[model samples]
Target: MSSRQRRNDSAPQYLDATTLTAWRNVRDAGEVVVSRISAEMENQSGLSLDWYGILLHIYEGGEDGRLPQRELERHLYLSQSGISRMVSKMQEAGLLRREPSPHDRRNVYVVLTDLGRDVFLRATPVHHAAVQRHFGSWLSDDEIASIGRGLQKVLTAEGGSEIQCGEELDRLVTFGQSVLALTSDTVAVSDAILVRDALEPLLLADAARHVTPSAVQDMRAIVARMSTLIDSPEEFFRSDWELHRLLAGYCHNELLRSMYLTLLGTLSSRLDSVVPTTNLTPYLYERLSVHARLVEAVSSGDEDQVAEAAHAHHFTMARTRLVDAPGE
Candidate 1:
């Protein structure tokens, strides 16, 4: 049989009615909830959901009520042009203004105007009521918790992680150099695997030696933050990278921690180049699970378990690059 035929033959033939019904119910319910809330938001506050989200993010960002332009882009899940256009409209409406960063001239900051703040404050209650009425009221406490856990698991499986473009690009360049040295020439699957084998042990060792209860709590918080970003791939990867960086910072041995960070910086950068654009959802999910497993292992403080988890994590990553290399 052809490879495609074999793949088709291997696919499941059927789904049970219960499973189908459950899936349909969830999808339909999501549509209903969003429609109801969005309609209410527009009618009551004269604001689109997008406007509310942008204003809310800015309002909660800090006491100054400012968000970096790039940071706002991540939150809004909009392209630069899209955000710029929206911001322009809002600016004309006298809701917000863009200010150039004092420290970095290239960067622009989005500051909520007094009018924007007033709108946000006024709309908050209406938004909350709509959500509670359309969505929250339907679920009991246990059901809500169960749904949260289930969704988190799905995100973890999808490798939803975050890393800033600028930082990721720098790491990629550094990593490409490291891979060149390790392989003495072209980068290959085995070379990537070898690099992982060499570095993960050091990271696991550091964690075992220095990761504290407080650090574990912080790691969990990062993971929780990551769970929320599954729908935002760019933001997810940036956050995922932040979680690893935070773990590295927890290591008591400064030299070892720095070395591990350098190695990881390179690996992540290299991987970014090779990762396929299509069919990435599954790959991301698996990546998320690996990170979640590593966090749990670290918290357990079992050297053997940590080592095993690290091995699996690095192995899966290396394998992903090998399997998903462009044209492969």
Candidate 2:
């Protein structure tokens, strides 16, 4: 049987159409193309095309890797709260975050976390491969190109243009190289301050206010794990990121998420270069204690309390970092 026949062979005997000659029939036949490929992708990889589409839109839609929730709602035709809730779920999975609009506070923007971006980068290839397996293998490149051009003409009427994920990756790689070139001058403390400021007030405050009960439980579980692993700083830090990454999802602001993540990348890279693991070992208990409190504050659904706790932690951490240590 042909690939198309094999893909959807459950047709009843009365629905006996071996070939699709009409334009409407052909269009209808292609309607399930995305669903078929997405199914294949899910079977092979855990990522679903729906999730991939959201990430793709954000990656392609925004200049600074941020896209408004409103635009997503339009593109996907989701209800305001529908998009809000879906992004919240992805946020819980540590794949996305929310932030208020820089231009309009009433609007929310969706952005990918570092982990979210990484997952997207990995899943896109699996998606392309799945497409080839399910459909591309049957069509020649020329045929595919012809279909693309033909479809573009129709898409043009709707003001849609093609955006390649590969192109976006290339741009990111180039930008990353430029940033890496200046790592010598990047200051960890300064970057940390900028990130902390953005996160503690607007981004995290939003998250705390919108946090669901299940989210709070998940975060507390991560914190509980941290307490057990405090002596094991390596494992503790992993859980640390898990808790914060989960918290990032609650904000529902794309712009804030982007800004916070950018500064954090710089802060993390610089801190890794400047701080030794041995030096960090002495402070794991304090780190765990502070994080436990931070999670509880968020779980309380009190944005003010979260901000206060976060502020106190930062200052406390800074003081510890600044104090001179006697020779070990």
Candidate 3:
């Protein structure tokens, strides 16, 4: 090949040194700010960062300062059981209370008590101060504007919008439950099967869309990273979530993508809980192969082929988790 032809055929390098440095700086700065703020929040208010976040979300959640239990779970970086326990503890402390949904007996809502509101009001200043000290202080006004513009561009590209209400909201809640069932070990096999069945069609539809080349490349990189982490279950699980996030990004439906992002916290918590004890090597390899097929199907833009690949992927995942469960 001619030298120019060889260069044209090579993969494009998206991240130059300056871009890499900026990305690392943002990541490190975020970690530092979070650490400082968490320590201050705990020391001054006796509230862990997670507790404070839950309280804050509850306070802003709705007109009545109440959020449904499942919605609350979405806002929280906790598993279903972990959030339940946290709610119980907060209730015992007179911070919050849970009420059964008036319309649906099976549903529960979390309401911030007067005391919870007061606590949140008190903690807001401390949180702001930490952010100012560790994060805001370091950035110039121009830099802040640039960062906001950059983030807005990202959000726009990702189909970001305010969470929709009504029927879409209901569907989102159901999606969250399905995700919990798929990730949590405590869910009954019957329930898991039901969740998988419900999710399969959605995944197939998402797979049928023609995703941007950047997304395809992102999945490829995630799969490569997963291969390197096969022996490190925790890291592998983290990479697994990244892969799902990329796949979810391919959904052409804005509401579906938004809902998927909302449930990521719960998904992360559930995956974290299961990774340590589960035999993950077999599952990892299976996932890598399935994802490879999925990428190919997506690239071809064949709806039937995409659906077939998605079905096989979900079946393999369910079998890996249910049939080959830890200690079984």
Candidate 4:
């Protein structure tokens, strides 16, 4: 059977509560990584991690390290359709140019443009900080070392090689479970609302009081904090909630804050494959100001101001996102 067919066939396997719960934690952790990174990338150079990955790959894999799309699909573990869409979007964005292979007309190679190279260079530091904050900050020195070995073992095992797992391996698994279990708080809603209210006024005032430049800086600081705690799932989720609540506070309309919070609460509900990978790019970063401005207006406590700011902010963010590379 084809891979897709096999996946479809496996869909109905009975999910025991333990396995289902484990799957949920895994999905939640991955979502935190994606959402936190995407938010930071959007605020930083405006590139999504997927888009950034595409550029990073092409940049590193020029003539010396050139790769075919098929190979890229394997390395990135993206489906054929996913790879195609990413390449197409990057091409349209003028970050890459595709050419038919000299040996096979049907084959194509993606090349990074000069502009794209410049973008990657400019974006690299931001990417580094984002990755460091999201994945780096959470691990202690010992956990970090263990994780490295564990990951190496996984890769080698996948390649038909075996690696010994020490006692710490079990400890890692146990620790991970404990972390996820902590986030299953029944009281999160009331807790979140309380926290949301405490911070909203200042955030709203800050957003309203600042112009675009200051607003972007303020938003980036918040996203940085949000992205830094990925190790402990409970802490990660709490930080994620705090960031959103702050946004709601900045927007200042309790109703609007609540509306956006409700939407964000669904992040952990869906399966991994259900959500499309995002293409973060520079223009997207500039557009985050919309959210900031809206929150600021909401903080001002005027319905007219809230409506006007939210409308303008959301529209601009949506419109610029339309300019994303076509296939992506």
Residue-wise C-alpha lDDT for candidate 4, range 146-214, written one tens digit per residue: 766755755775763343432211111011011111123312432333344444444454445433545
lDDT of the candidates, in the order given: 0.64, 0.63, 0.62, 0.52
Clashes of each: 18, 7, 0, 16
TM values, all candidates: 0.41, 0.43, 0.42, 0.42
> Over 4 Å off in model 2, which ranges?
1-22, 77-81, 159-165, 168-328
The sequence of per-residue lDDT tens digits that candidate 2 reaches over residues 1-328 is: 8665565555542333554354565576577777798776666446667777888888777668789888898777668888787788778777788888889988988988875666665455456656666677788999888877767766766776553445433212111101111233233434454456546567667788789999988988998898888565545655766677788778788878766766655544432221222334446667777788888888887767887877745641221111111221
Q: Report each candidate's C-alpha RMSD, comma-separated, in the order given.
A: 21.5, 20.8, 23.9, 15.8
What is the Cα-based lDDT of residue 248 in candidate 4?
47
Off by over 4 Å in 4: 1-27, 64-66, 159-328
Cα lDDT of model 2 overall? 0.63
**Candidate 3: residue 155 Cα off by (Å):** 4.9
Model 2: worst 10 consecutive residues (lDDT sum): 172-181
Candidates ranked by lDDT, best first?
Answer: 1, 2, 3, 4
Best candidate, TM-score: 2
Model 1 alpha-carbon drift over 4 Å, by segment: 1-25, 153-328
Name the candidate that leads on lDDT.
Answer: 1
Model 3: what TM-score? 0.42
- Better lDDT candidate (2, 4): 2
Worst 10 residues of 3 by lDDT: 168-177
